[model samples]
Target chain A: MPMTTAEKILAAHCGRDEVRPGEIVMADLDLALANDITAPLAIEEFRRSGAVKVRDPRRIVFVCDHFTPNKDIRSAEQVRLIRDFSREQGIENFFDVGEMGIEHALLPEKGLVLPGDLVIGADSHTCTYGALGAFATGVGSTDLAGAMLSGRAWFKVPVSMLFNYRGRPGEWTGGKDFILHTIGRIGVSGALYAAMEFAGPAIHALSMDDRFSMANMSIEAGAKTGIFPVDEKVEEYVRGRSGRRGRSFPADEGAEYAARFDFDVSGLEPQVALPSLPSNVRPVGEVKGVRVDQVVIGSCTNGRLEDLRAAARVLQGRKVARGVRVIIFPATQRIYLEAMREGLLEIFIEAGAAVSTPTCGPCLGGHMGILAEGERAVATTNRNFVGRMGHPRSEVYLAGPYVAAASAVAGEIIHPARVAGGDRPGEEN
Target chain B: MKIQGRAWKFGDDVDTDAIIAARYLNPTDPAELGACLMEDIRPGFACEDVRGGIIVAGANFGCGSSREHAPVAIRGAGVRAVVAESFARIFFRNAFNTGLPIFESADAAKGIVEGDEIEIDASEGLIRNLSRNETYRSQPVPPFMRELIASGGLLSYMMKNLNQEGKKK
Candidate 1:
């Protein structure tokens, strides 16, 4: 039987040759992850399950990215809870402060999850791995706990949607613009209970980092996951990280799809999602003059090394505007080191932006650079929900790295094209 | 299961952040989590006559983040059930896992007004507005998942299944 990539991956993991959408299958997981905030509750359920030992210690992973380095007393306790459970269980992948990066980014970077794998996590952005051709989705804490005991979890296979990208994006527009435009076209719940498959030449043209950004925000579109089919680019990335590239599951020819969309992104402009909703998207030209108090350039969505390079390109020879506070967070410690070595960190610091140690700070209002009440920010992070970054009255505008960096320099939401890229050189960060 | 409560109405795409802000996610006590329920969206929402209430919201309720905190806070606040036109994926599963009954019915979501006395018969998928004298039916939980809800999600199943496997080993 013909199957979509997601369906085929799930089917293979379940020891079946074929599976259909909406059919429940119990599939083995290549990996399962939980962060500090989620692990504590999952641990509680793990103990309540009356199981003293996990099904596979090697497969269970814990990362202390949220509230890492001990944000507060309770946050400290949350990490300690997971740390102790991991130690006792002999789980090999417990990532503490110095070793910790955002779990989704860290996992792919370390080659812990490979192509065509089936993965799950207690956090929603687990769908980020789908960028690498893996089948992944978020599960509740209880489901995580159940998977810990059984090494398997039930899944209701999702119908797949094919989003065929036909043309390349314009300058200053990339995968982030594509996804923001998609969400704007389709509401927040547009892909609810569906797998989003991106293909065609334009999708292949995107860098792996760009693909990661697109897949990371799939949850914002209400998708179970978003995936790009494996190709030479995928093989190259996996081969660079690990000798073994695992396996690849490509959708069969004439595979079934619930719906299909063709997006020609070559003419697309830089997009920004306005305050309070990721779906409230408009061209950068639409809301150009709205002044912002802060600018954040980081998160699992766009916090890769390439994101830093993009921001650095826009920040070179341009100082951050007088009153705007700019903060940049590299997604992982390795990315931090790479940025430091490449002078990206120096450029940001010279530009008046604080380059913090890798953490998810300020993105989920966890810490580091929270916005005050009545404040507005332009951020490269994923969601812009009301009060997401800080005070309920504070606002966040979601944009790509180029636009966010340009906004920092302009002190307002503006197109990168509107601001000269460091034409006047002197003390430009 | 029959749950009786007054209706609390909300608009569409009511995200998890609006349901419970990230700042209030800590300290894991149910009551503590409930204390600031929807405080971002409506100040003093927890202070309202919300106990024993059913939440009726427009389409795409619980649209962002798979934070189980969203449903936990609502269930902890003593909200009996949620009736929505539709729901985002993870929150729907989180609701069942946490034993917080949620239903999908465009009719119930649109017709039920705020503060209306409502009763939900979940097994039969019936939602009736006592104050408005109207009735609506929600899509029933899938057959296999019904067994999950009956066990209050994973508490019984995981506990029993793992324990039995332990003894066998």
Candidate 2:
């Protein structure tokens, strides 16, 4: 039987020749992950289950990204518990402060997740690994515990949805804009419980960084996960990262899909998901002039090296507008070092943006750059949910790095062409 | 199994963040987590105030994030069950794994008004709005899921089957 990429991956993990959507199966995991905030709860569950040893210590990882640097005593206690648990269980992949990046970024960079792998995490953005053609999805902490104890987790095999993205992308627009536009069109529940297979000439052509950005937001569209068909870009990215030769699964031609949608990006504009919901999006032209109190340029979604370059390109010589607080996170320490080597860090600091150690800070409103009540921010972070960055009334606008940095200079949401020097993009200044 | 409660209304896409904000996640205690349920979007509407209430919402309830805290907070707040037009996938799983009852019935979500008395049966997939003298059908909860709920959650379920070998050794 023909199967989609997700179905093929799930079937292989479950030791079945074929699996269909809605057939519940306990699938083996290539990697099971949790961060500081979630691992503590999962650890409690693991202990309560009378599981003395993890099924495979090396296969389970705990990344201390969420409130590390230990924002508060409570957060410190949580990390301390996980650290103790990791040592007790002989877990080898635990990462702590200075040695850690965001879990979603750190795992892929270390090649901990690979194509055709089945990964689960306590974090929603776990689906970010689908960029590598893996079958990965997020679950609650107890589900993380189940994977820890047995090396397997249950899944309701989801049907697939194919999104055909074609045409050249507009300037200052990339994967973030593509995904934001998609969410706006489909609403937050667009894909519901379906695997969103992103395939098309244009999707396959996107850089790995852009692909990561797109896959990272799969949850915002309520997708089981967003995946790109493995191509040369994926093979090249994985070649030097992991020594393991992971299996690859390709959807058979004419494999079933629940639905298919086509998008034309030739004239697509940079998109900004407005306050409170990622689905509430508009082109940069439609929502310009919304002044921001702060600007954030980093997260699991848009804090990669290329995202930094895009932000630095916009902030190269221009200063961040006075009275506007700008903060930049480099996604990972390795990415931070690479940004420094490329002098992107200098451009960011020279523009008056506060550079911080990589953490999920302010993305979940954890710490580092929280907004005051009534304040508004333009963030490259994936979410813009209510009270996501501190005060309930404070607002966050979700955008790609280019628009985020451009808005930082303009002190209001505006097109990148407005700051990309002399009247570029053919927009009247 | 059946649950009855007053109905609390919410619009579409009630994300995990709205169910329980990140600020409240620092403390994992169910009681502490539940105190502030839905605090971000509707401040001062304490979850404690809606004890035993059925949250009836538009489509896509419990969207965003895989934070189990969302469902944990819901059960902690004493919410009996949730009847929505639909639920985001992970949230649906989390709700069941945590033994929190949830139903998907668009008619119940739309027909049941705020503070209306409502009841739901997991085994039967029926939702009754006593205030309006009307009933609606929800998607049936699978047998395996009902088993998880019956055992008080996945943790208890895992104990019986997962650790038996280790215990024997």
Candidate 3:
């Protein structure tokens, strides 16, 4: 039987072939993880299993990325609990803020993940690893608790949604806009319980980082996992990063996809998701001239050095609007250090953007960049659900880093390509 | 193993936050949980209906957050079985490990309306829609999962069996 990338991964992991959608499969987990935010509950549930020792401590990684810098006493206590648990459990793979970055970036950049592995994390963006051909997805704290206890979790194979993107993106359009536009068309929860397989020329031309950005937002559309077939681009990235090489796996020719969508990338533009939902999106041009109170260019969604550099390039020698507080937090410490080393930090600071430490700060309202009642902010984070970051009355506008940076300068939603700068307006620089 | 009850149905994408939002993550009250299940997304899903029956849902049911509270809330609200066209990867396993019977029927939510009487044969993973006079086959419960539910849950089963082995020594 012809199998999609998802089916191939699940089958290989579970030691089965031709697994049916909606059928429970006892797949082996390649990697399991929890972070400070979810680790406390997971540890509690692990203890409830009554096991004197973890099934395999080495397989687990504990990251302190969500509320880094000890935002509050409660957060500090939570981090302390995780530290104690790691030390007590003898899990030396513990990563505190100093050593950690965003959970998804830290994992792959550190060579902890490889192709065809089935990994799980406590954060929804865990699906980001699928860019490298892994079937990685998120779980709740309790489900993570169960995995830590038993080392395995059950699954119902999902149906598949195949997205075919052809041609290149329009000027000023980046990976962020691609995903936003796709979600806008499909709506939030459109790919519910289905694996999204991204294929076609446009997808093939995208860099590994771009693909990572694409797969990362699958959960926003409620997909089980988003995947891409392993190819030379992925192989080159992984091999260069870790000095590790692995074979690529593409779907067998003519693999069956439950549903397919074809898009012309050149027609797409910078997209923005309005408040309260990821699906509430419109072309950036349509929403242009709208004002913003703050601009956040961070989170696991778009906090890499390239992403920061993209924003920095837009903000250089420009001042943020008087009332706009622009904050830029890199996804991981490594990315932050890289940005600093590359002098992007200087540009950000000179542009009057607050360059916070690496953490999931303000992404989930854990710390930093939170808005008050009737407040509004433009963010590069994933979800803009009501009360997600702070007060229920606060609204978050989701946009690409470039657009966010431009808006930080204009104090309204504007295309960075449109700004008077080095790159041409709407240029694919 | 057999599970018989009335039925409660939900649509797709019943997220973790909806099952139990992040604000209430710290609580231990499962009873209080039943009231809030689907409160944000489905408003009245857990309260007015969904008593003493199976839950049938469309594709991608229980898709978001892996909070086991979702299944806990369902079971706590007196649900016996969850029948869905498909389930999110983690939620699927969480239900079984916690002793909540979840069955998958491709026609999962078809013709099985809100107030249907249903009987589930866990051994065969079959659902008999008594109200619709239709019988459907579900995804088979694996052997280990059967043992888990039979022993009342993963923790209980492990405690009883493993602790007994210690006494045998």
Better structure of 1 and 3 per DockQ:
1
| Candidate 1 Cα outliers beyond 4 Å, as residue runs | A243-245, A421-429, B159-169
Best by DockQ: 2
Q: Chain A TM-score for model 2, please?
A: 0.98
How do all the candidates rank in terms of DockQ, highest first? 2, 1, 3
Give the least accurate 10-residue stretch of model 2 chain B, judged by summed lDDT.
B157-166
Clashes by residue pair, model 2 = none
TM-score of each: 0.97, 0.97, 0.82
Pairs that collide in candidate 1 are A318-A428, A351-A429
lDDT (10s digit) by residue, model 2, range A222-320:
998888788888998899898787677989988999999999998788999998899999988899569999999989999999999999999999999
lDDT of 2 at B108: 88
TM-score of chain B alone in model 1: 0.93
Worst 10 residues of 3 chain A by lDDT: A420-429
Runs of candidate 3 exceeding 4 Å displacement: A240-245, A420-429, B1-64, B68-148, B154-169
DockQ of each: 0.74, 0.77, 0.23
Give the fraction of reference interface contacts each candidate recovers.
Answer: 0.74, 0.81, 0.20
